[model samples]
Target: MAAGGRGSGRPAKKKSPTKGTGGNKRRGLEGRGATPPAHLRHWHKDKARTERVEREERTGGKTSAARPQTRTRRSEDAPEYIGGRNPVLEALRAGVPAAAMYVALRIDNDDRVKEAVRLAAERGIALLEVGREKLDRLTEGGIHQGVALQIPAYEYAHPDDLVSIAQEAGEVPLIVALDSVTDPRNLGAIARSATAFGAHGLLVPSRRSAGVTGGAWKTSAGTLATLTVARASNLTSALREYREAGLFVVGLDGEGSVDLEKANLLDGPLVIVVGSEGKGLSRLVAESCDLVVRIPMHAAAESLNAGVAAGIALYEVARHRRR
Candidate 1:
């Protein structure tokens, strides 16, 4: 009491256990070790890393740091080609349908360009003309031969007609519908995937749908030749007709009530509707479905690309159909 302050109730509170723990040599060195100083932490970290890498190498295991990563640009399903008289003529003669065609009006009308125009019109493709600069952008500075045609986006078949036709032939009809998929590439990729998976045909709206075009054909890598494509006046009406014909129509949505795997897809003919790249199935289309199904995914990803999602759905449907 005499040594301590008279008014203090007790000795001043000692520092916290952790405060001077670092300074206590006996406690710090108890395990035949000393705490690493701040400057040496990096050294210890690097040493441990080096040791782990060496051990992995000796054991024939790869370390995370040892693998190099790479990125690759996949070959597009449809790629634009630029060439002059002979090439364009060859493409047309080879049965490549040009979606849109352009001619240089200023040039003296030549028979080759005239024939190009004739072929395009015969095939019901649009023809237009622009300044050389615009043609340059379209042809990427390649020989345009004063004529270029945007290739047809996709091959189409009438959904109703396809179903009836398939039935008459004693084969189950498989049709895929798109809600609002606008990207020509996606449309082409989906077509390619559908054809590859043995789907009968593809259906899209007359409006807001990517039509058969060169870009899509390129994306399909000539798969369009094997597929029948159909354009619907109104998709809702078409879906109704499908249901009336005893076909099961399923819509793919992230919040679907039925898991795709458990859905009874093998029972009969079916139509799989995939939403647009940006917005999924429109309200009317979603409401028209006999069932709404979803592919289970982890919490991390909100959704998948429309083309990829369509491919997966088609694969699942094909798998069941084959069984």
Candidate 2:
């Protein structure tokens, strides 16, 4: 074996020269572009914090601290489905605008189902036959009774639009406002009373209040279709706006000083505010009322349900206006 030459331990293999692109390798070796801002980098620890701070700034600190810093906008405008044979028939008879009628396959053809299908067909609504499992899923496990009606999301009018609606109708503004009322049935009942007694529209807070739902539609007996519902971001601010627009704001309270029947303001442009049955009027809302009036009732009654109170107040207002 040679000493300095290739030894018995195995000769070293010859290396081949690597080939290179014209300038591709150089371009790759060159400075990768400038680093992005920390918030733009998904792997950076400060990215979420930076984004949250920016979002807080953009939203004027109105963002929910308890929610995840990453926020998503949810669509509240999605269509709703009301189920049950009686409810479907009632909605159809009340002429509630329906997009479609879904009947479970081989469902019992009851009188209500037949009437609902006939009415829906008359209104040019599409009828779809689905499996019972599909109907259950569509109604979110509600007792569908083999039928369901697809209702479009209720389009709420702006708070200011109620006044304009009254003006266009050539009538003094008569509006009903609900404060902190979460039950859709109460909202629907109040709407029914409001419509019966000549209210131009109904007002509700955007939060902590009920918007039109299937329950509301069923409870209202379809009166919500004829009545306009307005949503306010802040109920107190909406009352102030109504006052500025020359409408008298009245709050229904058990402890009110004025009796609803004798209140002379009822004949004029009015806004009747009804509070939740449990909590009654909130401090800010009670303070915003031009007149806090009470319905005459037995002392043992404690407090009237919000719908009943609104109905009594609206009836008195209607009677007064008729005089």
Candidate 3:
């Protein structure tokens, strides 16, 4: 209105002078130019995700993407056989302790097969040359790829022992319990996160839970060796046992009455129960919780994966305890 008259309809804005004015008006798309459109903000590719997809494609979807198949039925034995060259090679690469490597007689040498034999001999694992017929039976007639590796069974500790060990160490017990989380990678990630957040150990139900497998070991990136994982016959019963031991049992639910941020009981003995991604905490386990906590999210209907949920809860507990 000051520059023009009141009735003028021109946009009321000042224009910068040309070059040689107070400022160099060399603004002809200078200095990073304009930011791309909002849709272009995500123009940068996610390298990790791209690589994973590429590997999965190269392996015919048989990379870690098929890790659940690794959890597929295996012989119930102290030392179990993992068939397929890729699985065996992958397991060895992940540093899963193996007792021996079985090679089908006159197996053609490939990169992984050669590597497996080399690693077996290097790591002092007995190399057994067996007929394909035996390996066929050992792998339950599944594709063995002329190779198999024997991994020792996972040693599960008693749930009570987790708390007792923490007590003996003079530290408040912090444990994580998993219900119906079937992904071994998720299990391994939880182990890594639990260890990072000072969790004393982890627990999973005896049935319908991911056990420590080669994929899990790889996913943990070696934290699985340091974290004690226990298998509970019944999760509800385990909660009751923890409650009787004078520990607070908190369940992570999306619609619980208590807010995780406001629950300050973490300074004492505690166990956080994380449920499956799709179903959440089971009804019986939810009933056993001393308090059910729902973490505040950035948006409604948004949730974290089981491993991430467990990690965040553990981090919150550790934060409050530190405070």
Q: Compare the candidates by lDDT and give the number of the best one.
A: 2
* Per-candidate local distance difference test: 0.73, 0.85, 0.80
The local distance difference test score of model 2 is 0.85
Candidates ranked, most accurate by TM-score first: 2, 3, 1
The per-prediction CA RMSD against the true structure, in angstroms, equals 23.9, 11.1, 23.9
Candidate 3 lDDT over 244-303, as tens digits, reads 989999999887788888996878899999998968888998999898889888886577
- Expressed as tens digits, the lDDT of each residue in 67-92 for candidate 1 is 54364221223334434655455556
**TM-scores for all candidates?**
0.57, 0.74, 0.62
User: After aligning candidate 1 to the native by TM-score, how far in Å is the CA of 260 from where it should be?
Assistant: 1.1
Give the C-alpha miss distance for residue 268 in model 3, angstroms.
1.1
Name the top TM-score candidate: 2
Output the better candidate (1/2) by TM-score.
2
